[model samples]
Target: MPEATEDLARRGDRAFLAIGIAVALWLVATVIVLPIVMPDGPSQAVTDYLGALRDGDVDAAYDAAGAERHDADAYDTSFLRSEALSTDWRIQSVWTSDDLSPYDAKLTGGIEPEGHETQPGVRVVNAVISHGDATSRGQFYVQETGSRDFILNPFVYADAGATLGFVDLNGVTSPAHRADNGDKLTKKDSFALFPGFYRLYQHNDDLFRADPSTLMVLPGTDVDISTSLSLTDKGNKAAAKAVRAQLDTCEKSTQLAPSDCPFNPLDDGAADSVDAYDHEYRDVKDIKWKVLVAPKFDIEPRDGEGPGDFELVPRNYATIRLTAVGVDIYSDSDKAKRFSTVCPIDPEDLVLTVTASKSFTVSGPAHTYAGRACGRDH
Candidate 1:
């Protein structure tokens, strides 16, 4: 009877061991193997979306997030696929709608979602994405199409506006247009962009420059980045050169009042009698003009204008000496005499327009005496 009891006890031990092994096998399959084979959850959807961006795979990122691509000709997408967007990024944590706060869940109200609707099986995934020293917390809506498969909704885009007419994204010239926010249109020129790190600048750095601004785009949030452009050192130098060249062209003219020239010998009252000078000085042989002091001026950007628009504001008057060999009509002498006169030119603001090829066109100031002749020597 004792030997029978020992056999039963051994059999019982073997049965317990077999049951323990079965449980261990089940746990392994449930914990590790099933996750690999089954469809991804909401957290994985968010992870994949961010991962695609970090890899500089813009198409993959947009596909993973189910976001529609804007018309390539209409929107600027060069920065989204450039190397500037490739940065070290990681996902800190992801939470579902139940774990989010009321304010967090409603973050999508500002930006219009692509095609997502609040319904059953729709889950909002909140993730914390970290890049370098910056951390962005964003929310994404995912809908369950299958039992375990979740499709991430579209992400948010940004509109970049500039005080200048146009703005550059990562050194590419992007033409700006009026932004349509689904309700109304904006007054400023806007460029549609994807969610990523962008460098806001101007490609025409020789004429103008802005402080390089770093724009971080987050999900479910619309960003408007505005930058102010000012003239650069090179621009000032170019303006000075243009002003001097214009003045030189004016000096070459033999007329006392050159067309479109800031300096003129005839004042407003005497301007009408200028035509009589040529008849009066018909006996005179040659007329010469010499600039005494060059005009002193400063360059400034035109207010409420494009990047290429500028003005040369005069700081001081320019003195010009006119010399001629003519009969002195005041003395009633027909004999030729050397006549000399000095006129101080009050230079007005000169409009400077720069072209895309960096060529400068300087338009002289408007004067009352333009095209009028200088009367006989006073």
Candidate 2:
């Protein structure tokens, strides 16, 4: 009887060992193998969309997000593949819930068509995403088509407005007339974009530049992005050189008042009119001028104008030495006398127009003497 009990006990031990092996195999299949063969769920859809953007695959991203594609000619879609797209991103967490009402207040804040109620068979997938130094939480509504397969709701996008008139997105020039979403963008126009990261800046490297401004678009949100352009080190040097070249050209002229130049011998405060100054110097001859001090410029954009339109204003007066041989009209002498005087020129406004071809033109109104200057030799 004791031997029989020992046999039964051994059988029981073997049975338990067999059942443990079965459970282990089942766990491995459910945890590892099932996901490989199954279709993507709501969370996977969001993952695919963000991955496509990082890879610069616009078509894949559009398909993943179910967003409509606009014509390339009509819309400025080059930003999709631009280098400005942020690749430093990671998914912190993804949570799925059938009750979307809890997320409504946060996700739909500042968005149009507000106050959305919960729907049946739709799951709200909330993801915490981070890029560089910024992190944001966004929600996407997805519904299962079949089994694990799911599709994101259509027209799920965000709006981005900018304060700048003309801007460059990811090195691609985006003019003020057209937007990235095929809309005619005016001063108040906004771009409808998918959830992603974008960079805004000015592309005029020779004359103007701005720090790269970043925009993070969260789903169902209206965000504003802005950046102020300032003269680059290269641009400042170029502007100074151009102004000096213009002054040199003016100094080479033999006329008392060089046309389109910033300097002249006429005393603006003393002379009543340009005509009167011309009459006073009608008999002047052998006129020569030299730039004593070249004017310095502060490069800035013209008010209410787009990029490539700049105004160069002198911060200080420019001095010029003038020498001429003219008759002494006040002395009633017909004999010509050598006259030498110094005049300070005021270049308050100089227009510098930059074209698309990267060529620039500098022009200014003819400037008269800023301070008192004696017409006779000093």
Candidate 3:
């Protein structure tokens, strides 16, 4: 009897082991093999769409990626026929999740504005693409003064919490404009300067978009955003030589000659991205000369408080009337002037006259560009 009981128990254990192994094999096949074989939702669709786009079937490609682009509302197929679809732009990746269908790609990242002309060097992106492959390498004929991982933008010299209201450095002062003798914002101005946190904040409707239209003042010049950029890859001495040569041999008759001066015309007319310019600061084409509205506010004093209780604050509002007298910032890469030899403070834009009912910190001290480039309470 005991021997019979032992045989039965062994049989039951063997049956249990067999059932466990079968279940394990079935799970493995379902989890791993099925994903490899199946082409459903965004995955299968994204692959087909990318292939169609490459094959020049834009109609079919758009149909596939129609849901992913912001230009869908235009109702115009002709717009899609431009550069991003035809030339210089190509797909890098297309991701389709259960909820999102993102078309990722790299554009022939233009070294000039409008992203028209392509540069050399490859940069990758995982975001939704509407233009070209975001991974295309870039080789800029004219190296810009910034770093670009996915987005290309140049920066201006501004202290953190910097205000860029109009300032007259040519000895003329106005309520709308301040006078800095020679103060310069020391920050390297461009989205590419710090690519890590800056890019992630720029995505998803670009809620944290930083304005590239800011103007910077040269240290000591006191003029706002008026420094010229040098194009030649030579040091200070060599660049000075090149600029002198360029200024001498160039004919006045050439269309691009007179207009290419460091002091740009109000109607700035220059063409072709030279080593003397930035990709973002593309002359007067991308820039507009409009008035700024700077508003003012006052702090209310307490009833029992003395005169010290009253505080004067410039309300964060708007400023109007400051005009774009001239664009002094062109590429100084030819090395016309050293980056900055004088103090960053614009002596001309300094506090010429402060008229207020309440007294405050009257004038700032002489600032140097040698140290931190932030504001000196301007």
Candidate 4:
């Protein structure tokens, strides 16, 4: 009986050893294979793209994009370059993970805890070294939600200066748009830059068109918006009449070319109207207040100017002064000037918090626009 027990014990030990070895082999196989089976997503794309961008191979980076993003003829340099449209910037952080959202994966680092602010055109990495630096700056989400891609903005864009048709960001050299034309500009050809900052008057005219911040400030005249918008205040009755006329004319003029830009006439059909584009998605009238660009920025007047393509571009100059005015949805308390240091193109950034006494008073909105909007028309 003792001999039989010893034999059984040896056999059991052998079985245990075999089982352990099999498990070890399986574990090693998994270690070797799991990664091979996993999907490559935003992080991979972001890292590869960032590498290319850092190396200044924009064409290579552009090629790696998805189909819609890859369509070169339609989504060309201008589309990619116009992202510099926003000069104001902020950085937010998040954790480092192989599993990040497709949109969020385009970041090279983790999100940040404290945010850092800088002027619009500075790059993300350099912005960190600016006036108010931050730390542990993780993944960046432009706004509160995990959406807005801070890096894609012009500040981080590898070729923003090139996109602007300038050799660099400084003002020393004329932009390629200007240089290519032999510096000989025609009457109609001029440049239109989306404002570094601005506001849109609800009743300044018939149509509450906000795309071209100031409809036609005309060239050679330094029309301080701070003063001009202020002087033009009419009571509700006057405002209503003007709104009706402008709407009627806009609607009528727009009929000639449904494809023409409803506003911001590039060619005939670039309908860049904030109201017209968003007419169906959200009711423009339902919006509580019209935006007023705060006075910290300048817009060179665009009088006697027309559309521009690769050729004749309009050049406007502006210097931002930290001042703001209110867009009174309720009353015309003051109207002595054409523009006032009231309402800002971006309300959330800075509008006098103490400007008004009540919530019903003229405070900025959750968001504002100094941008051109286009879409599936309502």
lDDT of each: 0.59, 0.57, 0.27, 0.27
Tens-place lDDT per residue, model 1, 168-280, is 55565544443323334342233444445556654567776765455666566656656555677887788678878888888887765666567654534343222334443
List TM-scores for all candidates, in order: 0.53, 0.53, 0.22, 0.19
Tens digits of per-residue lDDT, candidate 4, 1-378, equal 699999999999999999999999999998998876432233343344334433444554444322123232211133233322222322221122422223322232222223333323212221121112422122222222233223332212111111122211111122323323244533112222211222223333331122334222111122222212111223223333433343334334322112211122112222221322322111111121221211222212122122111111212221111111222323344332122121112211211110111111121222222322323211
Candidate 2 per-residue lDDT, tens place, 1-378, comes to: 699999999999999999999999999888986655442377788778767776777788777765556522233343445354666666666666657644443343322222335445566777676777688776776665565434343222222333334455556544443243345654234343456665665346666664446666656444555445566677667766776677788888876777557655554532321122222333566878877777776877655343234667777776777777765455566776776666665565456655444445667754454434433324
- Which is the leading candidate under lDDT? 1
For candidate 2, report its TM-score: 0.53
Candidate 2: give its CA RMSD in angstroms: 8.7
Report the C-alpha displacement of residue 205, candidate 3, in angstroms. 28
Cα error, candidate 4, residue 184 (Å)? 29
What does candidate 3's lDDT look like per residue over 1-378, in tens digits? 699999999999999999999999999988986746554333334445545644656566545533333332222121233122222234444432222111112111112333223432322112232232233222111122234122221111122222122211112211222124434422122111100001111121111112322222111111122212111222222323433343333222232212222222112233411112122122222222121332233332212212121222334532211111122355454322211011111211112111122111112222111221211111
Question: How many clashing residue pairs are found in candidate 2?
Answer: 0
Sliding window of 10 residues with minimal summed lDDT for model 1: 180-189
| Ten-residue region with minimum lDDT total, candidate 2 | 270-279
Give lDDT: candidate 2, residue 320: 76
Error of 1 at 24 (Å): 17
